[model samples]
Target: MKRQLVLVALTICAVLPVAQAQKVGETVATPFQGFAHSAKGSQLRDQVNDLVALVRAKRLSDAERKAIELQEKFEASFDRKMRQYSFQSKEEYLEFKQSAPEQFEWIDWGYKETLQMKAFIAADKREFPTALSILATIEKIAPASAGTAAERGYILNQLGQPENALAAYKKALSLSTRYQSQRPFQAAALRGIGFALIELSKLDEAEAVFNDSLKIEPANKVALNELAYIRDLRAKR
Candidate 1:
């Protein structure tokens, strides 16, 4: 039960806007909103209904051009939203180059964390390759790319590819000695390895990895929750 709750928390924390439309709360103002939509908008509703059917079918027969076009639209939306944080955040980002030199070099402050959150959602949705692709782009730019590698491995484990996931986790571990000095991302890598081990069903190993992560980030809620769940599961067994 604890583990289930942990997963539920993770699901909520990791997931982005799973609902079809981007905006939520206040009002969509976009006519058709899920099942609550009006039957009067049948013409508009038909397209949504078709999308639902296609999603249920687990495949899209869209042509290559359409696929690319949709991907671009999604990417544009994601980028646009990433920059739409609080005014304070926008100001901080603008001043990133002048202040906080170490972190500023890393493609804006919250960029990596945002991508990590997005990847987590993708992993929960079983969109492994797409998640990896995002991580890969990050890897190409960040020197501390090993953390993303570990995350990718966890996603692989969730996809039932434990061997590959383990390999990726090991690669992340190997990065420890490679870094010239202690880096912030090392903590993230450790946490990722812990998550990968959990998904791989290596409980003992996962606990050790979580301990390592805690050594770096004692206040990490996800790691703390995960470790608690693992302890609960072990006690149950």
Candidate 2:
């Protein structure tokens, strides 16, 4: 039992999902790839990188302040842009959206990606409540965001709220249906679900969820480890 618990702890550490800013060595791969092509978006990306640098330098308060400022600026810019256009009907709005998808991508980047950084900063500081509040705001603004839902699940799991985490992960899976190509997000959500189930002492269910996660991400070390742990657990039973 002690060994099983240790495995669970290791699994949690391995799968703690944190939304990170684009690091220097990493490539920017997101659904909003086009947003990076725009001048304003590129500027915002730079600001986010600066925030990341502050965090890396152990300037948590400064990073948090910068994150808040960035969020506010993004909100103001988004509102100003929206006020510049007026649509006569829903059809017209849909037409505009189809024609100018980048506009929506920018909005999504502001609400999802930017806010995610804020939440990550708070979480890194061990300010879990503040992190959760930021995530809640993201959910309110972008209800269909699978990433946000999965993030919430990870946070809630850390808070020892497995039931809520399970719900959040399941919601992420449901929201991810529209983003069929985003298998990594789906696998992450499934892994969160499995972790939550393990916390609930539902070993069999957790094993099943981990298997499903592995099906999505064949190279998922976390799921593979958890599956081995679960099998060991059952063997001792």
lDDT measured at residue 177 in model 1 versus the true structure, 0 to 100: 36
Q: After superposing candidate 2 on the true structure, give the runs of residues whose Cα lies further than 4 Å from its correct spot.
A: 1-43, 49-62, 78-108
> Which candidate has the highest TM-score of all?
2
After superposing all C-alphas onto the true structure, candidate 1 shows an RMSD in angstroms of 12.7
Task: Please write out the lDDT profile of model 2 over residues 1-237, one tens digit for every residue.
Answer: 232211221122123222342221123345334433442334465576566566556676886798788877666655454322222123323455676635543342333555766777677667889878988887765554566778778878888899999998889788666443222467778888998898898998998888987787788777877787778778888
Give TM per candidate. Answer: 0.44, 0.67
- Model 1 CA lDDT for position 222: 75
Worst 10 residues of 2 by lDDT: 5-14
The candidate that achieves the highest lDDT relative to the unseen native structure: 2
Worst 10 residues of 1 by lDDT: 82-91
Tens-digit lDDT track of model 1 for 4-65: 21221122223322132123212222332332232122223233333334333434343223
Q: How accurate is candidate 1 locally (lDDT)?
A: 0.48
